[model samples]
Target: MIEANGFSLIGIYGGTFDPVHYGHLRVAEELVEVLQLDHLRFLPAHHPRLRNAPVVASHHRVAMLRQAIHGNVRFSMDERELKRPGETYSVESLRELRQAYGEHETLALCFILGADAFVKLPDWYCWRELFELCHLVVVNRPGHALLSDPSCLPLALRNICQERWAAHADALKKISSGLVYVAPTTLLNISSTRIRTLMASGKSARYLLPERVLDYINMHNFYAGGK
Candidate 1:
């Protein structure tokens, strides 16, 4: 285990964020509180590799995200993935972050992810090298099962999960290379898929999305029966 030097924690929250909603915002908020993070960056992927491309245009998606996260001082947007060519991968972004922040012995660069995403870590690009760059803070989300036993997971995933699992945020604070902490976050049962479908059906996605984001979507008439 690498030594923890009581470093400043910078949380990374990345997603396609087809539309930023309370599900995304609330999770980030609780994580900042639970981890006592110094800052949290909301990264929107331009071209995600594992999933279908977002229906909304890149500029519009970024605009909605910016409006959604507007007044929060600690929350900020990182457009590295958005600006990069080719499909966006988490490891690429993390590598850039490591290069930028690795010099500080007293800095913990953490990447926050959902349990659904974390379970599929084996399929991600340079996933093994991921631990070397930053610690993973996995937040539990609805509709995903958390495998309690390591043996039940894939060989690579089982090995990593068993070896790096951390019981507390302090455990992550004390190390650099390998630490995975599972966080119990607020269960907001909202998804971009559902949001899109609802809007396409001409239904108001009022509380599921932020007022500003809803307004943007309405103004653009996006997802209006798009198949």
Candidate 2:
């Protein structure tokens, strides 16, 4: 069970983590520092709804995440989604986390998502209810546009847009009544897709991922496409 008192910032960094690269780690680190997060949970997806197929197995993804975040006291891993069967939904994960952490913990649960994912929040399962559960921290990603189109957001979300983007933290806190936030970070060109492609072509994936993670990937013969 999770516990928190006062204003606790817990960041949920959910992803496939195909092989857990540096870009992913960097984003988490930056969010933790910028938001002064109390703790950051790295949730690996067992089955992502948007992805046609996962590039790597859950066990491997989890292991890679562990390796990537090793020695970081502020970071931890949660296999809740991986333990569940079928499609992995953010709403479900947040619900379970809320139950574990209690409702009146004065807690702030922030979801770390890329720009592309942020743009598609309206299509997520029970997306409206998600705002009532936790805040969203949208990170800048290469090749994705800002979420400026109101039509792309649900009615519930659009209603809280002012508070979500308010310049003042208190204003953000007031509207947060279980609201969502959009934190745009520096854009990094790195991506798992590009890493996989490079690995498949017999090229080096160095600098794309953490050294330990890359070793694990090579040891497991991952992304040697057409193998």
Candidate 3:
């Protein structure tokens, strides 16, 4: 609902968020600062189609996110995706948001994702149409190497890769014109997966997440392997 320079930059950070952690907060902060975003929303997917592992309950995830970003004025939580009944798709969410905000509102929406998700963009539902509604900002993950061999990519994806590497800035500008973009940033090695692993092993996940978030997780007995 906020606007800046006749344009509102709404950054969507969507994930299972089994538990919100420092890596998630760091990326959101970086995107807001670097991209000049007006506001950022932490969206927790209700049913992520691609995830094979069982996710924690949606309500718990949402609560954790709310706690993590409590004092940040620019950050807010949107449970729309988590409330949806079926499979969650970016295109569908974009359409709904556009309707709510109106098309001519001078708003620019961007979805923040890790580099690991970037390579699998082709497999997403209606991914091409998604770009028309919002920009995809792909942040690099620490220690995760990019594919050196482009030959292994699907022909369509390989072509897209060429376009991306050719003119990244131009591609980003063309995001609203139905072209995908890759945004590169400093990668942090922290991840919820690693954090959870540490907690289950009776180790401290101290600096890996916000102190309040860690307290909340401990209180709720989350990721403690049923302890």
Candidate 4:
């Protein structure tokens, strides 16, 4: 079992993490501070639903994430989705967390998503059930716009966002049922795709990702040898 390390409030950030980069970590740091989270959980999906299966294996993704967050006591990685078979869905992972954490009023779990991903929320499996499971922390990054107009949201999500948009960070700590927070973060312009491309062409993606992670990629020949 992964220890929460005395963290009552946690954020779940799930993604392919093919090779975790600084872009992913930078935003996480800001969110942890802004939301006052005890921990920001990095969850690497075993089988992604919205996009193609990650080119890198799930085990590799997990290792890279572990290396990326090694020193940060408040940041940890979970392997629940990696252990499960079939396609991984955001809602299913959230359900597992809700079950694990139980009904503690003091415990808060926030699901982190980029603005691009949030705008496409309706496409997720059991998307509507997400709000019932945990708070939604949406952040803006390149090529994605944070939704401001309620009309732009999916019909099903509009009402919930309208009703539950928290005006302050403490508002999220008050209740566990439903909360929508759009964080103004220090969004980095890095992308895993670009990193992979550089590595494939024999160029270094050194500073983009953690040093150990890059070493692991080099040792394993991941996205190397002009693939």
Candidate 5:
């Protein structure tokens, strides 16, 4: 873990990553630098609570992710959600991390997510407890607007986050959990859905994702024939 201000910061980036693409990588990379994260864990969900199961198999998805983040020391995969049975819940994984670190460790967990996801916070399982478990780093997506306007958030979430907003990213280092920080990252147009569509139609998806991951997908013929 990277030490800063007497604390270790670890970023937990959770997503389906059906086929890891440049969009996901660029955002994570920016967050790592913005948050001064020691390392960021890509927590791929086996079965997300709010969305349908991934189109690709768990093993294949995991393999692609490994290749996609191969040389990035600040990025690594966390197989906890993939190995856990049943639908994946953010609360459970964060709890496990906290327990593993113990109550006395000088560690900070930052949950990196997009603005779109943050607005739907109440729909998540044990959403409020998330604040007690880790700080939230909400990044602006291509189409989503900033949360600066209180009206942008649902009434419930807005009220809960009213006092949780941090003035800046550095505030996360001062507190272990229970703070919200909005980050501005490069808005890469790449998306996994578009890449999958191209692959299914026997079209080229080069440059949208890493060559290593694209090569793996081609070798296995994944997402083709409608998967």
Candidate 6:
């Protein structure tokens, strides 16, 4: 486990893994290394508040995610949001995690997301409280690049992030929460949407994701109808 200054750093990567792909896996792997995360939790959402419901069922998505990260020692899936009823709010999950860990002072929870999602933070339910619950690790997505300037960010989010910006990843290990760090991770062009479209069109999505995950998707015929 990765620890610094007597605090264990855990990474919470949440998304509607729809069907976990290499893009997601690569980012997680890189984040683990770059941030020196002790344990990285992949929290799959039941129904994202800011997005549409996943096309595939929760069970299937969870299964695919399991296969995708099968042998990764530091990676684990957290199914709490999947089991919860109704829309999934990140704040609630972080709150529960903070309580489970006993105190934010002892354990550092770093919530991971892409730059595209970070800009939309203000729209999230109780978004500001998230800073109090965990640090934010922002990575660049395919089209969205990380913007250092606060002016480039959404007004509300930009204002809050100004004081929360961390000079280095190590800063996360020093403080338990309320910091924003822009981490540099491998920029893979692969995306779940592209994979699904390829599968739906009866095209090959090989190498874009793990073979085990692909096999599982084929076995269940999960996105066969362009879902």
Q: Which candidate gets the maximum TM-score versus the true structure?
A: 6
RMSD of each: 2.5, 3.6, 3.5, 3.9, 2.4, 2.3
TM agreement with the true structure for every prediction: 0.94, 0.87, 0.85, 0.92, 0.94, 0.95
lDDT tens digits by residue: candidate 5, 118-138 = 999999999999999999999
Query: Where does model 3 exceed 4 Å of error?
Result: 1-7, 146-153, 161-179, 225-227
Better of 1 and 6 by TM-score: 6
Question: lDDT tens string, model 3, 1-227?
Answer: 32333455678888888778888888888778777777998878888777754356888888888889999999999889877788888778878877787875567777787767777778999877765677767677776555556675667767755654423433333234343445555567888888888888888898888788788788888888422
The count of backbone overlaps in candidate 2 is 1
How do the residues 3-73 of candidate 1 rate in per-residue lDDT, one tens digit apiece? 34566789999998898889999999998998888999998999888889899888899999999999999
Index of the highest-lDDT prediction: 6
lDDT by residue (tens digit), candidate 4, 136-214 = 9988878776766768787877866778998777777777758898888887788999998988888878788888888
Q: What local lDDT score does residue 47 receive in model 3, on the 0 to 100 scale?
A: 84
lDDT per residue for candidate 6 within 1-227, as digits (tens), equals 43546567899999999889888998999888988899999999999988988999998899999999998899999999988999999999999999898864568899999888999999999999999999999989999988856698888898888788998888888777899999988899988889889989988889998899888888888889422
- CA lDDT of each prediction against the hidden true structure: 0.85, 0.77, 0.73, 0.84, 0.88, 0.89
**Better candidate number, 3 or 6, judged by lDDT:** 6
- Candidate 2 displacement at residue 197 in angstroms: 0.6
User: Which ranges of candidate 1 are over 4 A from the true structure?
Assistant: 1-5, 225-227
Candidate 4's C-alpha runs over 4 A off are: 1-8
lDDT of 2 by residue, 1-227 (tens): 22332366788998898777888888888888777788999998998898766788999888888888999999999999988889999899999988898875467677778878876776788877877877777777888756666556657556756455534233333332454455656667899998989999989989888888888888889998412
Q: For model 3, state the Cα shift of residue 24 in Å.
A: 0.9
Tell me how many residue pairs clash in candidate 4.
0
